[model samples]
Target: MIRTPKKLWVMHRIGNKLQKINNIIKVIPEWRQRYIVNNVEGVNSKDLAQKWASYTRDSSLFIKEDDIVGIEDESRLLEESLMDGELQQTLISVVGMGGSGKTTLVAKMYNNETVKSHFDCYAWITISQTYIRDELFRSLIKEFHQSRKEQQPPELSGKDYVELVNILRSYLDLKEYLVVLDDVWDTNLWEVIKVALPDNHLGSRIMLTTRKEDVGSFSSGVISYIFHIKPLKGSEAWHLFCKKAFSSYPDKSCPRELELLASELVGKCKGLPLAVVALGGLMSSKKSITEWRSVYDNLNWQLNNNQMLEVVKSILLLSFNDLPYPLKHCFLYCCLFPEDYIIRRKRLIRLWMAEGFIQRVNRITPAEVAESYLMELIFGACFKLY
Candidate 1:
């Protein structure tokens, strides 16, 4: 089992990090002593408890034909923006925190028959916070090529910046294409890519989803439309929570004994669909009232001390904290790399085994257990794969 040069380099970096962690543990008294204390007060948390007994999470979380709950109004607004003027290209931007349904909303429209019929071609590209310029262009071109399935598409291989731009602009000259640059983090990248798009004034649409409001402003100068997605309302949040928690037991309602606890749990989610879904998933597995009570009691600790922090980080932290104790170490092991770095499943499991984070089971290799742990984190939305 010879390792590639890249893997060797990664192993080297992991080794260095392990050394650093050793030094850190030496200075700290113990893991239990190192804790996050919430001393900041004044959040006057509203009881926000609804008298509702049933929860309603969406049956279809996919971005297929069916419309989802909580953002029906925003969908209409987005449709209006897309159809406002005739023969004019439009710049549409959607900004929201992570797990706030930005991606899901875009997915719904990206494949919708109406949207597809409106444009000559469609390109959906997920531009992570860290992106490669040429790779972006290649992907856009590839998707465009895919949409039409042309007899002889332009050769995109080995093209330079100016050449690629000319190729793209030429293809889009007389055509109306709906291009979605999802999760764009930098305006500079937009500027570089913008040159490749021919205004054509033919009703071409460029939509982007991002976590940064500045990104929306930067991408959408004048005459551009921006939709800022807020968290779900309390009722909507509860519905989503119920959907997740009671998906298997539709007739079941939060017992009278647990209604107060359930309402408080929903309130703590603060209307984020992903957080609600994650909690519901966590609870769905438990068969006892005490288990639900345990989550209800620990929601504050799981969410950390400050509720005033960034909503996306808070939601992500909640998901991470919900991972089983053994999975916790495996999930955190991923943080050794920089943010927005692409981590593959195989490499991550190998590293976990190296760090002894993977649990050994009877007749099962550590890698098998580690892979299962990784899947849990991914399904829980705490960990994302490349």
Candidate 2:
């Protein structure tokens, strides 16, 4: 009878083992399907990775007005420019390198109570690198009518590009309108869209943000009308960095022991608000001194290779990619120099000339061409003069 009980216990043990194996076997197909969906049958793995990175970055970097740092002066000046401008229609362009807070500053001003009260109607449109005229017109029409709480025309959906433009023009012809075009790329876009925006001689205003200085200059011919946004100053950058990095900690302050390492990491960001903010958010979850040291040590690699910092890379690359073919070569050549190396203007031009990045135009010598390229780089915010 004891032997019989022992056999039954063995059988029970075998049954449980078999049941566990069966459960695992049942899940194998589900795991296989997930692998196939993620790696083979659906979006490309690289694309999926990029999308995930973007989602993570955006979620972590959610900005509130109180969270905004280093733009108070900019906000005030931009507001004044928009609200206290000439009676004639004026175009004010906010020009800056990507990640310099052009959109943030303008968005703040666009939504200000004082600004809203000053203008009869407001329409904020985002004109990215690629825009369709008809689609833009439709968006404008909707924004203009909706801001005033007026119903759009029933036939709006049926109107063509010209009709849409006319409708917008006619609607804004009498009112003092404020229109914001964010992220403009090409000058020709402005030339085309400006026709639809009537001057109306009623202090109507148009605001645009662009990474390209030339685009800003084209939009607003006067120098005063173009606001060149700079990176955060040292103290401001540190303040902003601390705000993001220690947001969850008491008083949103960095620990005394970690302050040096944190400051070093912030310095790597070069005072670009987006970079500082993103890096801070990235460092927030890391609590140890060793982790902070690791980040500081590997920041250059992370900026180039890590997906979390991809947005920063993308923003910095915009200006680089916008360079002319020769200028692109020159800019890359400049990167060959060690960081913080003071590159003499004449020597750099000589290097460019040797590298064949400069060519003589009709009246301009190769030296002059190279000089022009350097100025372009400077104006594009790629290089800073000390």
Candidate 3:
């Protein structure tokens, strides 16, 4: 059984300190598994070994070049957008659906050569769904000290904690830097923390990433500039799949039949990189054209079974279905078209008009209303077209 660090530590404390000694003794006979053994010496509890393992996992989370792919344009855009701006506390946000590469884009920015060379200081923190301002501050402090290889002093609490955060912000204020608040979901957190930041205007930028538009809009105040990242285009998606599935992009000697079928499936991916990779990997083991067709035929069914599929089509369907009533109706209507269809903006608006889904709002024409609904649906992950 895999034990959590907390459970093992609790067992060591409330039960027997000698139990760890017994564990060490039990591990000796299995010397082939010596690496798995925990050597608890000065530390009296099983928790020490668990803590060490946890630290090892945390250290390995750093991004490596081979692990990153297909985000060069995003990196340049973020770097230039930040450097071009002169305003204090410039907020640059990355917005996209989950698994659409927002976090990956931010990671590329955080680890890029120019970014590293340009900024005097940098901080990266992941704000999960349940974000707390103080927790975020502490995480930033830890990241700051960790990057500089400086020792963190004893933890502060209450008012001392607030003062400590101010100190960290002041230190950041002294140098030009990039601060990335990743996977942010709360607007309230921005409200509370934006006041604490020193307006060091030397091209310092704060980059945020979220799956929600309102969160980005509220934080950045320029919804137009919010980079709404999407999936890989057909060629990019095909290339990505070929690399992962065949260990190279179109490895030697693919049958014409197999190539055609693969192209068809790639179109259904709707430029979503993760879906392309997942479907490609799913068929990687089967060399037979028959097997490939069988899998391709059931792509829609596979989407619903998370256990058997890693594709996010089902989740995207959920987001699509959650749109406002008129938008929901309009989006579903587009599904009638063949996959990879290049939908003309004018034609789609006219169709919506015929269906009576669009009505005049303010002085905006019915066509504008239809177009706005389509845009909203697209941003919501409910619609995808070339």
Minimum summed lDDT over a 10-residue window in model 3 is located at 52-61
**Each candidate: what lDDT?**
0.68, 0.72, 0.62
Better of 1 and 2 by TM-score: 1
Ranking by lDDT: 2, 1, 3
Q: Which stretches of candidate 3 lie over 4 Å from their true place?
A: 1-73, 85-87, 156-161, 220-224, 248-254, 304-310, 313-386
lDDT of 1 by residue, 150-202 (tens): 64345666787877777788888999888988778887766778888877887
lDDT agreement of model 1 with the native: 0.68
Candidate 3 lDDT for residue 148: 68
Residue-pair clashes per candidate:
3, 0, 0
In model 3, what is the error at residue 334, expressed in angstroms?
40
Q: Order of all candidates by TM-score, from best down to worst?
A: 1, 2, 3
**What CA root-mean-square deviation does each model show from the true structure?**
13.2, 20.0, 21.2
* lDDT, residue 31, model 3: 50
Name the lDDT of candidate 3.
0.62
- Candidate 3 per-residue lDDT, tens place, 247-266, comes to 53346234576898888877
lDDT of 2 by residue, 183-223 (tens): 88888877788778887888988888888988888854322
TM-score of each: 0.66, 0.64, 0.59
Candidate 3 clashing pairs?
Answer: none
Candidate 3 positional error at 38, Å: 11
At residue 368, candidate 3 shows an lDDT of: 76
